[model samples]
Target: MPSSAAWLMALLLNLMLAISTVFIGSCLSESPSKVRLVGGAHRCEGRVEVERNGQWGTVCDDGWDLNDVAVVCRELSCGAAIKARSGSSYKPPAPQEQKVLIRDFNCRGMEDTLSQCEQDGHVYNCPHTKDAGAQCEKSPSKVQLVGGAHRCEGRVEVERNGQWGTVCDDGWDLNDVAVVCRELSCGAAIKARSGTSYKPPAPEEQKVLIRDFNCKGMEDTLSQCEQDGHVYNCQHTEDAGAQCENPDIDSPFIPENVRLVDGPGRCQGRVEVLHQLEWSSVCKAGWNLQASKVACRQLGCGRALLTHACCNKTTQGKGPIWASQMSCAGQEANLRDCPFRSLEKNCTHDEDAWVECEDPFELKLVGGDNPCSGRLEVLHQGTWGSVCDDGWGEKEDQVVCKQLGCGKPLVPSSKARKSYGPGAGRVWLDDVVCSGEEQSLESCRHRFWGYHDCTHKEDVAVICSESIPRL
Candidate 1:
């Protein structure tokens, strides 16, 4: 019904709209390349990694001066450059992709980006040992750890401009604690200590730095997390504090330990062990029921399940297999006790063996063979876990003794906390407060099941009047 000229004009307008829409869409979808510090304990310290072309590769630290590092720190939203380090502080991975992405980045401590700074080239001829490392500090704001048993765990403190202040626990949780841990290069946020539960507070100038911190838990540093960053109505007593857990070792995988992981239930999953100071999977080659039997006993499980629905070959982990060519006669008390050969070649993590065993001790003692004379372990929700000594008392020990039918408790001993070995699997319970009148150990005030504020070293132990044999 319209004229040709009118229709022509309408079509041109529609074409223009489509073109503009596409231009805006492309702009919105474009993701800027990012740089992150990796392999260090904190977000502000580590080997430099740039995310470009959808792959993360390392940068050569050969010409890594503090001036260049300042640009990187400021670009990543961390505050100031502290030190530009060379040489890997950690052991290099046995197998690495080792892509050299950036090199010879020269900055004058004022540039906004490495790309903006002068560089010799995008790709450099350098060894991985020359990989750049850096440590950044948030200027005007600083974080420190104190009052903990170790350097890693502690009451968190911060400094702003020239005045020092404490953070409040208004919206504190593990996620917020995680940001602090990452900021400090501590392992992970174990627990948020509240109400002065750790120890007497240190005497200092009373000032609150930041409050109402809202962290998504994935932030690299606390500076990147959302917070009041300004005002609050909290007293110094209500000031927040954090306890972080450092990794047992400075590696991606834990070594010197053998444990089950990623299973739906306990004592089942991919079999992994530490060999040559690196944790790796056990190859399925030469694996059999006899081999599985040794694994079950080594982990304190009763027997191996043969059903595919419950047990099957497991090949889930990253990296190559560690051990192979196993031959077990089914009577071995420990997997390490069984005959096995180490293999460096011809094995992959996908070929790792898997097994599930019958449930272990519903309730038992560990770190000693005696029935009533070791660390307390409870079987709950298909896993064996340990309790903490935070608020443990004689009343709580009495219930444990009564539940085990191990006779009346005699002088609930804290010494056993050291005499008995630390637990291996998980620190499962904490802040247990029991009344002597309770019928069982479960009837006590404590953190939620699987919620704890301790490491294995702080596991609680008990000693009863006499040892009781299992029924």
Candidate 2:
């Protein structure tokens, strides 16, 4: 009804409005939201944080479960969700600084993004300590034991970023080995071996992923164990290995070829090896404390206490002395793992290698005129501390004297106090009640370690006879 120019203008205005509406709709579909894992051991693990309106915030753990984490893992391109951790276990680092954006995500696990899930975005007072977290099976974190006679025994290796590497043997012990065995479904670890003892060492090009591990021996996997992933200072030869119980075999593997002889006990004696059905003594050439440590560990004894000095006092073996020189770094799990070289034929049985592995009793006489008499102290958790004398008597004195290789008690505990002064640090044991027949002080009844009613002034003292034998 209007003029042609007016009609054209009206049509153009309508077209412009429609185009603007479409453009706005497309922009809304392509959101700029982002999600990430924060403060994890690796990129694929940690507290879940989301970005909204250019502000980063954490997701609340309310109703968080594996289903919610699976959606998150897939959205982040992580493989699969292995764990849905909440509370303090996966608490965000500096959580107070981050806002709580998302709450109660009801993820059906089919949603491509967390934003698509049914979530309560309106948060009230969700605690940051209740932040949601996820551990994903990110395809790169894996572990394996290799190069053993079977699947259970071998060198330890871990995978990271799509490459396999070894673990260093520094401080590698039974606890760490037990974790590996449990992870691989191998039974309890028989020994935590080092060097190329089980098989040839890893290739020189293989990097060491774990420098050191401190597992409490109860972790489901190696990732749960505490480890130093950075700063590797080990060679291929120092690769850690393990010997675990193989169910396929009739019996568990143990170091049976080696034994101790002609000494007070199985743990302390002359080092002998059974070869070709004949037992022979190890020669003194190149014998040292380091080699003795491996021998003691192999025999299921504790650490080596006295090696060279013990040989002179122990009875001599009456057999051929092996013409081999022991060169051990003191970290090998088995004595046979140490390097050996041919020695001269001049060595005799009297000069055989003798070792005394530390017994259960780590008692020592301190501030005394002689090794057999002084204020009594015991080693507990690597700290030397005094023992309370609430129930100290002659029976307690006799046990301490015999345990120390001191023939007998010389003076009564009551009369013995004046000569020795009070001890200094923690009162380790109290209400002592030894039965004289017990071999060591620890074998006797006492209060729980570090539980006592007496002070250091009540520290017990002992005086044994001067006929102290080698301990």
Candidate 3:
């Protein structure tokens, strides 16, 4: 019923539509067969299969989003997401097989591969499939720290595909050695020689898989860079390895610098000299108050105003060096603190030591008749000094008593009248100042001196308020 011209035009339009549909279908069918993942799992950038007709093809990653890349990076452990590109680095997989066409791709630049991205399908017009081709890129091997024969040096072993291995020493260089050093935080690399200095490799272990590793000498780990084929012929004796050294330890204080003086216990205010990189006992000579005060000041104990000299017989036994008797002016805190007019002579090893202290509070005695009553004194220079009973108040007494934690202070004295047994070495009381508010005797002073006041008869002693408690 239509005119001839109208009929002809309709036929042409139908033909054109058919041709267009065919062309579109052909374009859609050109997906890739094989695809490549680049930038590791952190930054996936590549194309995926969309169609396959024997020859593989790729699709554009137009639909990829950040969430998709996040999933990919998380699975790879390559780091955070960076960037995701929809392009082909290698031939895409066959379309007939299950394919990833970039359904949902989200990258934060941390992913190592595109597969890590959360993608769904391929984007048409993708040009990546044309670049389909893959090469076996070498990965770095893991190195661990271990204890070696001398100090803390040890050998390194490589791991791959869950299998442990070693590297042949064929072309070991400073660059390679540097990687090992940086990885272990050890010192600089000393050498990179071939030849076995280490024990033989264990049996059943795979040979080192890397032969030619081109390092820049600054990489922290060998695994961070790329390498060549697996290396063999590197036995325990010929394989590459490294060694490292330990750091130095510090020690500034010792015993040779001390000298004992007169106090209470076998160990009391003592004067020791820090000399020859060691502490040595001094002979008691011109030990006096002045000298004692000087010594106390040197020891940062305020001032040395007291002096005590008891023949070595008083102390338990003469230490390293011994001298009998000590004389000093009240001007110095320790014998060492005094300027000697002439070294004392006729002094026996027993009387060699003396003590000096600035304030008598540096020393204290614990345990005795009363809680506040005990034998204790500090050494200034080489002279021994006693604490004043001033304010021999309960508060002060509490400190002494509680320090010994024996009994309460029944009597407090200002002068050295207790006439306890002969004392021992010099004692050093860091800092002692009783505000009377201290809860316990010990709490009043920083720490007690080495010596105390106690005669052979009473022998200053303490009785705990309670019986010995379990630890």
- Give the best candidate by TM-score: 1
Q: Tell me the tens digit of each residue's lDDT in model 3 across 103-194.
A: 33454545444443334354444443432222221233456432233222344556665444556666667787777765543556766644
Candidates sorted by TM-score, descending order?
A: 1, 2, 3
lDDT of each: 0.67, 0.73, 0.44
Least accurate 10 contiguous residues by lDDT in model 1: 306-315
Error of 1 at 470 (Å): 17
> What would you estimate as the lDDT of candidate 1?
0.67
Error of 3 at 198 (Å): 2.4
lDDT of 2: 0.73
The sequence of per-residue lDDT tens digits that candidate 1 reaches over residues 51-142 is: 45555567777678999889888776677788898636632310144476777777888976666666554564577777888888744455
Q: How would you encode candidate 2's per-residue C-alpha lDDT over 130-206 as one tens digit per residue?
A: 78888876533466777676567888888665456788888899999888776664667899997487545565545
Better of 2 and 3 by TM-score: 2
TM-score of each prediction: 0.37, 0.29, 0.24
Sorted on lDDT, highest at the top, how do the candidates line up?
Answer: 2, 1, 3
